[model samples]
Target: MKPVSELLKKRAAAVRSVAPESTVFDALHLLAEYDVGALVVMQDGKLQGIFSERDYTRKIALQGRDSRHTTVREVMTPSVLVVRPDSDVRECMSLMSQRKIRHLPVVDGDRVTGMISIRDLMDDIIADDEMTIAQLQSYIYG
Candidate 1:
């Protein structure tokens, strides 16, 4: 399995983020703009929490809280499960599966590098398998 650092390199150049004090409405807009399911909640270059669609739906929509007024800090998922850049991709997948979560923030010491979804891991695994199959076919037939 590749390290999380390799996956990070393949990700977008910017890691979209918002401050804890940002309104849920604004966070939602950022999510839409970035075409992502979640945004990292950061303040002073540190990861505070993660604000996601799940957080919005369960905490604001279901709870009848106004997104325009309510702060992301009110609904954001805290104590986020983070993985170091050197962490194995498969291990991160297992962690997300067992925890029933979709996103994992890649951290190196005190800095947040990037985030990865289960979809990213699955795509990487599938690509690796396809390459192996191609190599096997070449050896067998050529």
Candidate 2:
């Protein structure tokens, strides 16, 4: 099984984040520019919450709130589900599934190290499975 720490290390460890006081419009801009679905909300270098496209759609758009004027703290998901860098990808997947969350922030001690998305986990799993199958085939033939 691939550990989240390995996956994060192989991929970029950079995680996009915004201040809690930042406007939702700013978060949206970051999300679009980074081609990411979510942003970690930080306050003084501490993880505050998470803001995602889902929050915008369900909390802002549904309520007809102005993204430009509203702060991310107003619409962000404040529960802030997090996982350790050494955690297994399967555990992360299960936590996300149970919470119905798409993104999880990875922490190393008290510091935010990286972030993982459901799509990222899925892609890794698919690639790993393919590699395993290929190795098995080679073993049988050789």
Candidate 3:
């Protein structure tokens, strides 16, 4: 039952972000450049919202809005779901599943420390399962 802090330690510390006032096209560019599906929308060094590919497709493209002219704040998910460093990984996974969300910002106090995706949680779970199986095998053989 590893906490999310352990997972964050294993990942790159840099959290890719964009300003709320930034154009959707610019945010999309950042997303492509970072090779990520989402970007944290920040304002005054605080978490404002989250901009994701799903937001782009449903809010911008589907609405026939111009990405070059539309602001990220206009399409970003403003009501973000956040977690803390000490939060359990399993709990985060359950929240993501129930909410049908892919990304969650890891906030400690007022600062955003990192972001975790469903993929990250799933990978950790798989690794944990493998380790448990190996330990069981070793104990049985010994």
Candidate 4:
């Protein structure tokens, strides 16, 4: 697997983020618009936290809080686990698996660079596996 930076490079879209002060409704809107499960919470261009569908489900919907009146900072996962640009795909997988999280923010210091999801890792892994299989088949057949 390649470094996180490489994956970031291959990603065609910019990192989707929302402000911590934004309403949960606003965050949810962005999530839906982008078709992503999670978003990096940025405050003044710095990584502040992360808001995910799980956060909305667990903190807002379960608690009966109205998203329009609730702020993302109030319910976001503030003590965020992040990966560096140089981090290995396996390292990210380990952290995500152990934490039972689907998303991880890629940061350089406090600056949010990108976000990675479980689907991204799975796609990369599957591509790598397919390439390896193709190589083995060519070697055997030739």
User: What does the lDDT read for residue 100 in candidate 4?
Assistant: 98
lDDT of 2 by residue, 1-142 (tens): 6689888878765779988899999899999999999999988889999999999999999999999999999889898989998889988888999999999999888899999999989888889899999999999998
Clash pairs (backbone) in predicted model 3: none
**lDDT (tens digit, per residue) of candidate 1 on 63-100:** 99999999999999988999999999899989999999
After the best TM-score superposition of candidate 1, give how far the Cα of residue 111 lies from its true spot, in angstroms.
0.4
Q: Count the clashes in each prediction.
A: 0, 0, 0, 0
Across 3-94, the per-residue lDDT of candidate 3 in tens digits comes to 89999999899989999999999999999999999999999999999999999999999999999999999999999999999999999999
Residue pairs whose backbone atoms clash in candidate 4: none
Taking every candidate in turn, the Cα RMSD to the unseen true structure, in Å, is 1.0, 1.1, 0.9, 1.1
**In model 1, where do residues sit more than 4 Å from their true spots?**
none
CA shift at 124, candidate 1, in angstroms?
Answer: 0.8
Scored by lDDT, model 4 comes in at 0.91
Better of 1 and 2 by TM-score: 1
1 versus 3: better TM-score goes to: 3
In terms of TM-score, which candidate is stronger, 2 or 3? 3
Model 2, residue 85: C-alpha shift (Å): 0.5
Angstrom error of the Cα, residue 49, model 1: value is 0.5
| TM-score (C-alpha) between model 1 and the true structure | 0.96
Model 4 residue runs over 4 Å out of place are none
Number of the top lDDT candidate:
3
